[model samples]
Target: MAAGAPRIFVSHLSGIAVFDPAGDQVGRVRDLVVMLRVGQRPPRLLGLVVELATRRRIFLPMTRVTAIQSGQVITTGVLNVRRFEQRPTERLVFGELLDRRVTLTETGEEVSVLDLSVHQLPARREWEIDRVFVRKGRKGSAFRRAKGEALTVEWTAVTGFSLEEQGQGAESLLATFEQLRPADLANVLHHLSPKRRAEVAAALDDDRLADVLEELPEDDQIEILGKLKEERAADVLEAMDPDDAADLLGELPTDDQERLLRLMQPGDAADMRRLMSYEDRTAGGLMTTEPIVLRPDATVADALARVRNADLSPALAAQVYVCRPPDETPTGKYLGTVHFQRLLREPPPSLVSSILDSDLQPLDPEAELPAIAGFFATYDMVAAPVVDEAGSLLGAVTVDDVLDHMLPEDWRETEFHLDEEVATDGS
Candidate 1:
């Protein structure tokens, strides 16, 4: 059988109804009695004990089942008429297994938990079978249980389903944020419940979590950080941009802030403290440690190579920043920045200084928020490098973070577009 496929296992007690060649009602699925091993191990399939209207139990071998579809089970041959044994309880409710993972023997397609469609036989309002519903068919209001609708096909919709990892449905879905754009990641974070947010974050790989955390709101960052497991929280804090790390730490309680800082690597802790030492609203305070630094004497090729090698988040700029060298003051001595796109089109061996745009659009360490926002608007730049008077680079301010100043309270429902594919029950 292929991996990550959808398959179904019918329980002995799974409801099974029978019909004759003319489709007349005959018998129903009774108990699926499997024999357990003498030791504490997995059980083996025995046979199905179906019930007939005659109130007698008929034993049928498992091989007799021909097909199962839309919740209906079919047998290969008709059985002798007899009374059925009274059932102690109703068959397992379909809703109980909606979000459960299944492995299909035929195909390897792994699908998320989605709604199921069921079919009801005519004249019998009680009998229904669950099956995969093609997305294209049943366009109107057939799925919706309004008046004149005799059937409810999508009664089996669940929050989510998994075919490979049985218990990882929610975690896997949320962990996909690592591959998403920053805006999309932010949108998903805002919609998740507090508990769910923590659960998903705990499951994410540390580096991926750091990437996603860079895009979340400060309030959300504080909430998620507080709820995360200690090790995971420390990892996220260590891997994040210095400015982002400081902002999150400032929002946390004093005790938590100290504890988390202690957990972080010393170098990372010092970097965050450096950013935090500045006034909160200034450009230096808002700057990140992720500026695209390059040697002034290096070739354009060298700068491009460094840009490719850097482990930056998605929202960062493609512009390569030029400085004399890491050992020298990068402030007033800065050469300029060259857009990687433009540099790639030029000759490879060209000196970076020749390609650099020396305009030096700099943000002062003490600049106010409005002044900084206007600077972005004036330059049409996605990011601007902050520096001190001695030409040493402090950090880079990203445009997306600046936009957070504009978001309203009801942002998630109003700003994000989501499909109604995953169904969550009130419970």
Candidate 2:
């Protein structure tokens, strides 16, 4: 935490904010780019990936960065709006090289690179990888006795991975994050470059990928979906909730939408088509066709089980609809809904119909956005069923979906800064 510390851990630099020379905030350092050099020499710093408050990322050359500290970075106040695209000669330190294996020059022992530090060299504008932190005896070496302490090595003492992606591919990246929840993985993807994002998306399973796509910003969602092969995109679309899939498809050109729909499961495609037929602002467009459905006589226990589906969001899972025979959604008749709170209060054996909130009227598929919002606010409900004239259930709109539509279209791309204050010498 010294003034413009010359040596620092890469992890500490990962999320630090970047500010302009005027002391006004710009954005945070999403990642550092370096140009890989010939064999045995450490790569030199090339630029920074700056993530703005709007969730959009831009590239800033190292020449534009004036200072670095534990919590903040200083920029020359020049920002390039062009997105970060990797040149063949460059590499990302944390994203591609961190946690990689390297051979120590002193002991000739293998170790995992734990962190690294870059320093401003002779020229005021030039920086180089001068130090490295490696976890010794990563598996079975005698240094394992150090008990989790990492050895700080100068960059010259170890060998670096040569691949642009650090000798790893999409599969390796996916395996590294397989344990993370879809939402967590989605968050990581949002901060990565488009190529890296596409690599990870290509490696995720259809269902897991579907979950993550739903959490991404609309533009990112479309881009990732576009990266998938048509067949696989169709599969992922099928795996996604009808409402999310519909919204994503609706964003594409009509022909592209038709092409993707053609490859989806007939049933899913039909549901998506029906949802898309309604105006994007209508209840039908915001609703998922596959809400938990209960036969009028289904027990409270059954209702609980239906909502327990892992794929359902909290709002979507908060209630179960009661319909006549053939209780699958889009059912015979929309009897009413049984809120989870009602189910828990009643005995496990109580029929869903026994606690149905018949007073909470359903919305018409064509109900406008404001009317739908009003229904949710007035009823204090997280979800409401949509029904047709025949009184048959069409779908259910969750509060989350309504909010997604309500927020400004560009809300996701705005840049923001943390409220914490950072003292700098303005070097």
> Over the stretch 244-362, how does candidate 1's per-residue lDDT look in tens digits?
78888888888888888888888787777778878777787787776777777778777777767558644454677777767222333666778767788888788888887777577
All models: lDDT?
0.56, 0.77
* Clashing residue pairs for model 2: 52-415, 53-414, 53-415, 53-416, 54-412, 54-413, 54-414, 54-415
- Write the residue-wise lDDT of candidate 2 on 1-427 in tens digits: 2234456556677657888877888677767888878877878888877766555567878787767764898887767665567677777775677656667877788777656778776646777788887776643221112234577877788874674433223443444455656755676688667876776677677888899998888889999989788999999999998888988998999999999999988888999898888899898888889888878878999988887887678987899888886765578988888888888888899888888889878999999999999999998989999999999999898998888788877555443442223322333
How far off is residue 28 in model 2, in Å?
11
TM-score, cand. 2: 0.69
Off by over 4 Å in 2: 1-39, 44-91, 96-168, 175-184, 415-427
| Segments of candidate 1 deviating more than 4 angstroms | 1-186, 309-315, 327-332, 406-427
* Per-model TM against the reference: 0.57, 0.69
List per-candidate RMSD values in Å: 18.2, 7.6
